[model samples]
Target: MNVELRQVHDSDLPVFYRQMNDPESLRMAAFTPKEPADRDAFDAHWAKIRSSDAVVRTVLADGDVVGNAAVYGVPGEREVTYWVDRAYWGKGIATAALRALVTEVPERPLYARAASDNAGSLRVLEKCGFRTVATASGYANARGAEIEETVLLLEG
Candidate 1:
């Protein structure tokens, strides 16, 4: 599948919300659920991203939304996070999206975190030039348990 990263548009929220709330996607992402995300939440989320200087991109595969990837935080020091639809897992879309985000930002020392149990995510980070920097325990709402998170960093 051909994948490319582009700026997120308001029209993309429905697709974004669906992928984000998918059981498998949330499980891998370690997101803490408060309530079912509504259009308002999506609006606020996208608004924050749009108004911020951080680089946020949507991964489109064959004209369909496959994932969302972004670098956010203070300007020079940024954290990267991405979530791909469960159906698209293991298809190299995450790697491609990550590579594109990194290339676009070209900022030094990008940070990423993944649940230690998530080998696929860790592998993606490793493939994208991130080296494990630390590991810590945290609560994953998606997993509903305390889990170890491996922190990784990529330096320009």
Candidate 2:
């Protein structure tokens, strides 16, 4: 599959919001709850991403938005997060998007975390050069249970 990263635009907000609010997306992302209580928060969040040098890319496959990947937090030390549409799962979209994001940022010692039970996400992180360094017990509202979180890091 052909995969490319593009800056998210105002025109993409609706689709972006929809994908973000998807039940499956929330579950995979370990979101605390299913509530669209505030729009301003979402607005402010995207605004910062748009104005900052930090790279946030929308994954496109054959002209469709399949997922998103981003590097956030301070430079040199960054956190990576991504989620792909459940419908398109198992197609290497996350792997491709992550590889592209890493190339675009070139930041060292990036970090990522996934619920330990999320084998798919763990695999994606591992495939992209992140190594498990630690694990922590935490409440994952999306999973509706306390789970182990695996912390992974990629050093330049």
Candidate 3:
């Protein structure tokens, strides 16, 4: 798949909304909104992020809107995040999309987090050059419990 990243388009919001609600994907992500079904809240959150200066983009695979990747938060504390459709899991789309996003932004010291148990996601982050910096436990809405989370960083 020709995975690439591009500015998030107005039409991509609906696609992202659907992808966010996938039960499997949510489970893998762990840290998610408590009310994933609340369209109003979802819209509000997206509106804020899209309106902000965050480096957000729609992930495309062979020209299809497959997911999203972004770098957000305070300048020195910025973090990198990405989601690949569950169907594309293990296909390297997430890794490619994240690398592309980092390249486009060209700002470093990026942070990332993943459910400690999500090997696929952790591997993707590691492959993208994010080193494990710490491990912490947090309430995971998707898991409905406090779980171990891995914190990673890519230094400039």
Candidate 4:
């Protein structure tokens, strides 16, 4: 699979919403919005990000949208995040896409977080040179409970 990252287009929101709503994906991505099914909220959130200075991109695999990735937050403390279709999980898409994203935005150190149990995501970050700097707990909307999360940092 040829994984590539490109600017977020106007048409990608719906695909992102659907991918985010997948029951299995949500369970795996525990730290999600309060209401993943709220289209209004979803749209509003996307609008905000797309309009912000964030480096948001649509992850394309061989010309098809398979997921989304981005680096956002305040300078010097920005964070990285990505979501791949469940079907595409473990296919190296996330790792490739994230590597591309960091290459595009070389202003690290970039930070990332993943549910502690999400070994796949942690591995992706690690492969891209991110190191676990800390572990924290946060309320997970999808799981409806607080859970452990790992914090990682990538330094140039």
> Residues 1-156, candidate 3, lDDT per residue (tens digit)?
899888888899889999999999999999999999899999999899999989899999999999999999999889998988888888889999998888887787899999999999999999999999999999999999999999999998
Name the best candidate (by TM-score).
4
Each candidate structure's TM-score, on Cα atoms with residue i matched to residue i, is 0.92, 0.88, 0.98, 0.98
* Per-candidate local distance difference test: 0.85, 0.82, 0.92, 0.94
Candidate 1 local lDDT, 1-156, one digit each (tens): 898998888777788888777877777778445443665776777798879987888899888988889999986568998888899999999998898889998888899989998999999999999999999999888888889999899997
Q: What is the C-alpha RMSD of each candidate to the true structure, in Å?
A: 1.5, 2.0, 0.7, 0.6
Whole-model lDDT, model 2: 0.82
| True lDDT of residue 7, candidate 1 | 85
Which pairs of residues have clashing backbones in candidate 2? Answer: none
Evaluated at residue 60, the lDDT of candidate 1 is 94
lDDT of 4 by residue, 62-101 (tens): 9999999999999999999999999999889999999999
- lDDT of each residue in 1-156, candidate 2, tens digit only: 898889886777766777767776677778434454356776777797879866788888878888778898887668998878787789988899899898888879899999887889999999999999999988887778788899999998
The lDDT ranking, best first, is 4, 3, 1, 2
What global local distance difference test value does model 3 have? 0.92
Flag clash pairs in model 3. Answer: none
Better of 1 and 2 by TM-score: 1
Candidate 1 ranges beyond 4 A from true positions: 36-39
Candidate 1: C-alpha lDDT? 0.85
Provide the lowest-lDDT 10-residue window in model 3: 100-109
Best by lDDT: 4
After TM-score superposition, the amount by which residue 154's alpha carbon in candidate 3 deviates from its true location, in angstroms, is 0.2
